[model samples]
Target: MESYIQISKINDFIFCPRSVYLHTIYDNFHKKSYQRTPQIAGTIAHESIDTGAYSSRKRYLMGKEVYSDELSLCGKIDIYDLQTKTLIERKRKVVKIYDGYKYQLYAQMACMREMGFEIETLKIHSLSDNKSYILDMPNEEEWQKFIDIVERVNNFSVAEAKILADSKKCAQCIYQPLCHPL
Candidate 1:
């Protein structure tokens, strides 16, 4: 039997399959060089939400985990407004705004949907630019797209393939030496 998959990994794979393939299949991961600005911004944003001290007039919770026997997904939701019953997913980045973040957020919303919670909205925040985008959760048709992506990830896990030789992405991975012999 295959091991269970994390919804976050699905998001990671979507961001860049090469990264995911290295992280999961080869057990390779890039080391964090230092405490970066993006990481700091995310931490502060989450702390503010969890405390409910922010002047924003929204009843929300931070860092929620939605799980199921068939699938388990967990992440820090920046804000969940009780009035609107929305789950806010946030990302703080200096450069690229990858779609992987959206995929990851959507998976979390799907998990919440499975739990019978009505998610009114899914929000993404770009800290650098101070802009927000709302992902409409009321739309059922959108879920089909996510389902297809998830299935593709599942299929990738079963296929037997060796790691590519001497790739830069491999060098940064923890399992580099094992997967690719230099």
Candidate 2:
């Protein structure tokens, strides 16, 4: 059976498939999560977005939830400028454009387009830097890349996943403590 992927999780999935599995464990159990300052800050930064309080203008779909039946993916988009045909994905900070970020944006655009939204412009807005990176829409091949990720995630299982214990990537992960257990 295929997994019902979340557009927001495309970033986490690329960052580490195992982390996604661990995160699901937390969510399923409703465990108390110990978050660092950055994690709390990021959540605080998204308060408005989570509540859909972005713009008063009708041209923008602020904090709107979109679903893609084809991909079995769903997520709330930060901002969709209907007038400009732009979809903006906001982050707490962004010093560099990573593949994880790009894939998340691509997944969002693909799902939106499938839902009949005009999405010609792709963008990522960094709150810390107050800068936006405008990107071109993903092509068919790019969309296929995201599709491949979805398939991998569907096949991924906690028992079958490998834990990269000594990877430097773990240092940057919020779930490192739970994942590594000191």
Candidate 3:
């Protein structure tokens, strides 16, 4: 059977490899309904952006669903600037660029490229800071690293992928109870 991967899974693996294992291998886990203020805010922001409720003067595409058969990956891009050939991702916070975010963007970019879009730049619009970061696309080395991570996760057995229950992240994790039973 042909296996496919979601862009979110790439982020999850980067956040915690255990999350990928638990989410993919186990069917018992339940998603939490209660979202924190920040998460809620981000969701709202993304919805507005996705619905084209937030307008810009530039010619662009919003909320495009793209998939790459070559990479067997799929994701929706927040925005694609037609005139500038740039991709924009929105986030509620802008502390720093994480590997997960980078990989997510890379997957989106790869999908776009496979679809024959000319993507020249990558940008992240940080709602908290009201700042826009013009990011360089992942270089060859970073792309290789992402590919390696994907391959590792694809081959990971349930037992080999242990739960990494970090104190701070656990509080936000939906599968926390499963990982750390009281």
Candidate 4:
């Protein structure tokens, strides 16, 4: 049976595979009282972007959900400009483009292409710096990389997944207590 994975899961795996195990297998998340400032800011930014109230630019389709059966991946795109064939992803802060960001966008691009949209460009709008960064569309090699990542995550056993935890990431993770107990 083909395993279905959320695009956000791909990002989580890239961020820290242990996160994937904790979220998908262990079924753990930070408690409701655990306030995440970055997450809260991101939510507000996404809401503004979704409503087309963040910028004065002409609005296109907003928060469109896309899926790819071939890859068994699904996600909601922040914006899609059909006229420019561009996909815009809003970020609360983008001090540096991380692999997780690329992987998430790659999954979205694959789903969009499978849905028959010609994607010419991928852009990340950093709300914090008020800057936009254009990302290169994934090529065949990049697509293969994404596929490999998916396969690795899907094939991991609970024990194998546990090895992906890193102390640095664990230090800042909200699920730290769940991952590491004193």
TM-score of each: 0.63, 0.89, 0.83, 0.83
Residue-level error in angstroms, candidate 4, position 95: 1.3
Per-residue lDDT tens digits of candidate 1, residues 17-109? Answer: 554565564333232432235445566766666675654554655556665444444444556677887776666653444566667777777
Which consecutive 10 residues in model 1 have the weakest lDDT in total? 26-35
For model 2, how many clashes?
0
At residue 143, what lDDT does model 3 achieve?
Answer: 86
> Per-residue CA lDDT of candidate 3, range 1-182, in tens?
67768777888787777777666655443333434456567778898777877776569788888988888888799899999999988888889988888778888998999999999998888988799988877788988998887777667666767756467887766555556652
**Pick by TM-score: which candidate is best?**
2
lDDT of 2 by residue, 1-182 (tens): 75477776777778888778777777665333656678879888888877766556788788778877787888888888988999888899999988888878777776788888878888999999899998766678977887898777666777755677667778888778778754
**Per-residue lDDT value at 171 in model 4:** 71
Give lDDT: candidate 2, residue 170: 84
- Highest-lDDT candidate: 2
**Which regions of candidate 2 fall more than 4 Å away from where they truly are?**
1-3, 28-32
lDDT of 3 at 19: 73
lDDT of each: 0.60, 0.79, 0.78, 0.77
The lowest-lDDT stretch of 10 consecutive residues in candidate 4 is 26-35
Q: Model 4 over residues 3-80: C-alpha lDDT tens digits?
A: 677787887787777777776744444434343566666777788766767556664777788998987887788888
- Given candidate 4, what's the lDDT at residue 66? 91
Judged by lDDT relative to the true structure, which candidate is superior, 2 or 3?
2
What TM-score does prediction 2 earn? 0.89
Ten residues in sequence with the least summed lDDT for candidate 2: 27-36
Residue 4 of model 1 has an lDDT of 51
